[model samples]
Target: MYIPAHFAAGPDVIRDLLTRPSAANLVTMTSQGLLATFLPLIYDPSAGEHGALQGHLARTNSQWSEPAIGESLVIVQGADAYISPSWYASKAEHGRVVPTWNYSTAHVYGKLAVHEDPAWLGNHVRQLTNLNEADSERPWSVDDAPERYVSGQLRAIVGIELVITRIEAKAKLSQNRPDKDIDGVVAGLDAQGHSEIAADVARARLGS
Candidate 1:
């Protein structure tokens, strides 16, 4: 992650990236080579020194069975959008502005831990389900299925935990732009329906 100091994410942004309901790409080095999986993860702040990421993989996914060599990584990203020079007030003033991108992301590195116990898997799945389904009109739960069927489904997957060692995150949300330019960017992004990244850029501007 090539993060300029001005583009570095604040602690609040990092916390949101971790705690928000989302998915990340988990990458690990194996004896064969590098393997990756996009997984829905939850931040477990109580798990370790720096906490851990909890998720699961299907039993058939070879990546889960393979022993990860050295440190593993999980890439978490928030909203990203294209920023046109046309959106910058400076573009009209000097015609020197160029197009760019605005985004927030984190590189989480940690040791991998696998769990086969049905009890742990059951608890993990329930937490994950609740987190994602919280906004739904009628949320689903593990208990919604037959006990035997749920147990069988759990048996078909393996739980994975990434005990965090470190995290490097960046928020390239036009924090370096001047106030007038940033205002233009926010308005342009909102008009384009990129509300999330637009808000991120607006927040970054205020933070700066």
Candidate 2:
């Protein structure tokens, strides 16, 4: 993560990246080489000094079973978009503008803890489901399914927790641009149906 001074992420941005309804790429280095799994994770604030990310992998997924040689990594990302030079106000004034990208991401590093316990898996699934379904009108629950079926399903997966040691995060949301150029970017992104990253840029501007 090459974080420029102006593109650094703050505490709130990092918190949102962890807590939002999103997935992460969990990477580990093993004798079999580097293995990665895309997984949905929930931040558990009480787990360690810096908290932990909790998720699960299928029992058949070798990434969970492989012995990690050292610290594991989780790549969490937020809204990202392509920024057109036409959106920059300075483009007209100097014609020196080039297209760029706007994004927010975090590289989370921690120790991996694996759990095969049924009780742990059950609770984790419930938490993850609720978190993702929070915005849904008819959110489903673990109890909605048959008890035996739920237990059977849990048996097929293994829970994983990343006990956080450190994190390197970046948020490059046009923060380096001038105010008028940033304003143009917001309007352009909105017209292009990228309101999510537009909102991120707007918010980052305010914070800056």
Candidate 3:
């Protein structure tokens, strides 16, 4: 989350990441220690100033039962690739370039609210399903299953709502590097079948 000015991502970028298919690491500090869960969240931009996140945890999970310690953090990560030192013009010129990782990430801090209502859980699950299935030609829906089965599934989980207090997003896509080095990185990533990361690096360069 220590972002330099060049790599800082704004509101639009954070919102886009949250709404995508990225899985978030939900972290909370308990009296015993720190706990984390990996889950896909439903982002609602209109719900708050920074937007709200919705997800669920298994009923047996101890995370929900623990008292809210401080602010909870949800980390959403995007495409990332290893940048080789050879992918820099400076490497050949002065042999001063070093390897680094190029990636995009967002840290969302919020207040956690847990809910056990079956109706709320069902609705949240439906929304999450629709968001992820939208791109599929034949999208499956929660209602596609039998009513009894769906209700039983809902009972096995607890719904979570995180009211976003703030967000810090970063896109370390070689923004600090010169245009020549960045171009080389893009080329290398693309050649290695990391088109997503390559595209992100290109986009970052263009935005700069």
Misplaced by over 4 Å in model 1 are: none
Find the 10 residues in a row with the least total lDDT in model 1.
199-208
Each model's lDDT comes to 0.95, 0.95, 0.88
Clashes within 3 Å, all models in order = 0, 0, 0
Instruction: Kindly state the number of residue pairs that clash in model 3.
Output: 0
Rate residue 179 of model 1 by lDDT: 95
Off by over 4 Å in 2: none
TM-score of candidate 2 to 2 decimals? 0.98
**Residue-by-residue lDDT tens digits, candidate 3, 1-208:** 7999989986666766888876789999989689899988988878778779999999999998886799999988988889999989988899987889988898889999999998889888998999889999999999999999998999899988889998889988898999999889999999999999898888888883
- Model 3 residue runs over 4 Å out of place are none
Which lDDT tens digits does candidate 1 get at residues 1-208?
Answer: 8999998888999999999999999999999899999999999999989999999999999999999999999999999999999988898899999999889999999999999999999999999999999999999988999999999999999999999999999999988889999999999999999999999888888883
Candidate 2 lDDT tens digits, 1-208: 7999999999999999998988999999999999999989999989999999999999999999899988999999999999999988899999999999999999999999999999999999999999988989999988999999999999999999999999999999999999999999999999999999999999999994
Error of 3 at 122 (Å): 1.2
**Candidate 3 global lDDT:** 0.88
TM-score of each: 0.98, 0.98, 0.95
- Candidate 2: give the clashing pairs: none
**Residue 158, candidate 1: C-alpha displacement in angstroms:** 0.2
